[model samples]
Target chain A: MSIWEYANPKKFMQTSGLLLPWVTGLAAIALVVGLIWGFFFTPADYRQGATVKIIFLHVPAALMAINGWLMMLVASLIWLIRRHHVSALSAKAAAPIGMTMTLIALVTGAIWGQPMWGTWWAWDPRLTSFMILFLFYLGYIALWHAIEDPDTAADLTSVLCMVGSVFAILSRYAVLFWNQGLHQGASLSMDKTQHISNVFWFPLIVCMGGFVLLFVALLLLRTRTEIRARRLQALLLRERMA
Target chain B: MLPELGKYAATVLGAYALAILLIVGLVVLSLRQATRMRDRLRDVEERVKE
Candidate 1:
């Protein structure tokens, strides 16, 4: 069957309901194992010391924060093009989760930076762009609530999502574009020389996997709730009309 | 037993605490909303049938 068939609400619900338990279980396992490994078993950095452990949460949260927005951007695009309610609701469902990720990243980054950089905050390009991304998330969520009509809210937020995507891209690559930032270069990169050492790398990869799985599980759950809420609204409206 | 975190014990622990708190809060809120929506939808569906 074509992928679009799942765009239908019933099919989407059926598949997601079956998938949710498995995804949630895997996410929990990965997160528990990864965090315990990173926190208790990993060696401290010579320079950064135990503060290095914060990387487990910071990097993964930062990655998901950006990726969550990208997911919403794609969903928004689909809604704009295909006029699928599921796509629109999915975008709506993703915003708060993205915002929380962004908040986690920022807070953890600040805590890590306090010792490493001798400061808790900076206007460095990467940090600044991430802050902007957080604001975009807030604006996107606020726009949804402000509009009473679902379709109109979806339309406006889709446009907003498109506009905010530029900043998201900027946030993702600001380190590359600006070399002078206090923020360090990527921990995981294609260049082996630039990559973090294997000692810390393995558990980090696991943590990243956990974060991704967690995002998927949360997205499915939230999207199903949004769909149900929409259906309830429709049923109430029908009853009123009758 | 906790790993020896040196002078940054507070810092490391604080970050983990905050992050975990936020994540748990988000999960609880989402689950609560999902349950509420599910129950409301079921009730409406039942009333409509009646």
Candidate 2:
């Protein structure tokens, strides 16, 4: 059947409920194995030492933080175009998870930066753009809570998501835009010359996988909750009318 | 039991602790909200049936 069929809330709920347990279990396994491998099994960097371990969390979280917004951006567009309630609620469900990922990335980056850069904070292009991304997430979430009408809130936030996507794109490419940033180039890149060594790369890939699965699991759970809440509101309204 | 993190022990540990705390907090909040919503919807559905 066409993918749009799942856009129906009941079908969405049925599919997600079946998928959630498997996704959650895999996420847990990948995260545990990856973190344990990175923290305890891997060798320390000659220059960065144990602080290098922080990369395991920082990079994955940073990746998810940006990707989560992109996911919302796509969901928001679908809602705007298709007028699907599931799409709007999915976007709403993703915001807090994205916010948390951004927070983890920023905090871990700062902690890692202290020793490597001899500073806890910087206005460097990459860091600055990421900061703006974090603020956009805050604004997106706040807008949802502030508006009482779901459709209106979804409409406004979808527009906001489109506006904020510019900054999200900036956050990802700021290093290429301005070369003077204290932040280094990408940790994982498609370019073979720029790629991290396999010693650290393998576990990192696993951690990234874990983070992706975790985001999906959380998104499904939260979206289901939002759907249920919407149904409850509808039922109550019907009761009042009756 | 643990790798020797050298002088960065506090730094590395602190980052892990904070990240884990935030993730766990998010998970707990999500699960709690899901349960509450599920229960409330079930109750409303039951009352409507009655």
lDDT of 2 by residue, B16-45 (tens): 999999999999999999999999999999
Q: Which candidate has the highest DockQ of all?
A: 2
- Fraction of true contacts kept, per model? 0.88, 0.94
Model 1, stretches more than 4 Å misplaced? Answer: none
Predict model 2's lDDT versus the native: 0.96
Interface RMSD of 2: 0.4
Encode model 1's per-residue lDDT on A147-225: one tens digit a residue: 9999999999999999999988999999998998999988899888889998799999999999999999999999999
Q: Give every candidate's TM-score on chain A.
A: 0.99, 0.99
Docking class of 2: high
User: Could you tell me the C-alpha RMSD of candidate 1 in Å?
Assistant: 0.6
Interface DockQ per candidate: 0.93, 0.95
The alpha-carbon deviation from the true structure for residue B21 of candidate 1, after best TM-score superposition, in angstroms, is 0.4
